[model samples]
Target: MSTEVKDGLRISVLSSGSTGNVTYIESPHERLLIDAGLSGKRIEKLMGDIDRSLTDVNALLVTHEHTDHRKAVGILARRYEQLDVYANQGTWDAMAPRIGKVDLAQKHLFAPDTVQTFGDIDVESFSVSHDAAEPQFYAIHYEGKTFVILTDTGYVSEHVEGVIKNADAYLLECNHDVEMLRMGDYSWPLKQRILGDKGHLSNEEGADVLMDVLGNRTKRIYLGHRSLHNNMQSLCHLTVASMMENQDFGVGHDFELLDTQPEQATPLVTL
Candidate 1:
């Protein structure tokens, strides 16, 4: 058997979109799943396809209680037995009923703005504006590298931007095209919710945040949590790229830009 020593952090977007959202992060000392949105079997298959094992996951960090983000949280926790699930108390309480039973020992609570170390990786939860009890965006630190998993929030507060500034990589959301969302068949209330302060970020909004924070250390940016119904991957990519270019940020030179799909896993990005 060929032996390869795995070091540093490896990240992959298992799936991302309105249907479901999940991300796999493998630090040198711990394996983490940002959200267990898809069915347990589907998550397992995705992990397997990426040459990783679901049963080896060390933790499941749920951002919020939304069905699209917590569908398999409980099932995976039960099946794995060893997986430690982390979420804020508000999220745990709101999601517990829908996710089914998770042992008291297995459930862990993390407060916003607190940095908790699991093995060699340090995970910090930062408050985010979302229509949930308490949603958070994660900034993961390992071996001097930082990777931010940012999505599902309508806007990023100045404090959050300061905290996540100059990360090595980012899985940021570019959810929808505002025009498509406005002109689509969805009801007015739903469209309003998406465009509101507590809804998903549009391409313009997400790009604005990236333009402000990306720096010398920033390397890879994976645009995620896109709206399958209202956003085309090509359009989302072009929009973000065009905006960044306007600010003198050249794609593939300043940083590598990639899109995460709802049904497929992004290529494993190792930092």
Candidate 2:
């Protein structure tokens, strides 16, 4: 299959949830994986299904030290001799032992506040509220277009809103339905952790953040990292769409709305 990227930018969510999380982002000159939570073999298979190749990936950028987000980091880096795995110093220090031994040359560290250039794509990492060592979301700029990945965040701070405002597209988290989570079977401590300041975003909270950042320039929004039990795809879509509609924004016309599943790759999106 041809690996050529069309138009401005191409994005695909390889998987997104508690089980595993990875997102593919590419510019004309470079390809990147946002996270490598699944086994390396599985991630490669997912990429193959979308007519892309893991061999073509230039780097892997990790969000934090969570096992579900860095499960295959070491394996992939070892397999792909030239691949560099990027993360903050804290995340690297916290996740290194868990991911096993990666080649010394393959570990690349970036400060949260600085912009790192990868070929024609420029990546900027920003702080997020999560229980990891130092979790962050990323914004990519290429060909004058912006694509932001904002998931695994407990709450969107004012600074985060400003960083992602008016982006061309977004992969935002819609982690759970608060009511469902509250009444569900999870242990009280687990429930509290999921709802706390360092936990995931609920449908309502996700909608509010989108409402604050989305603008005319916004073209597509993918709801990501949905809980298997606490959130349903249809429910997440409905809740966020309704919120947008109430704010006088036409869901389909103003911007495309989609959801990412933990076991499937999303349709390749080009912008």
Kindly provide the TM-score of model 1 when superposed on the true structure, using C-alpha atoms: 0.97
The TM-scores, one per candidate, come to 0.97, 0.97
Distance from true location, Cα of 191 in model 1, Å: 0.6
**Model 1 Cα lDDT, one tens digit per residue, 1-271:** 1124288788889999989999988866788899988999999889887888876778999999998899999999889898999999999989988998998899999998899998889999999999999999799999889999989999998998999999999989899999999999999999999999999999989999999998899989999899988899999999999999988897889789998888699878787
132-151: candidate 2 lDDT, tens digit per residue: 89998799999888999998
Per-candidate total of colliding backbone pairs: 0, 0
Residue pairs with backbone atoms closer than 3 Å in model 1 (clashes): none
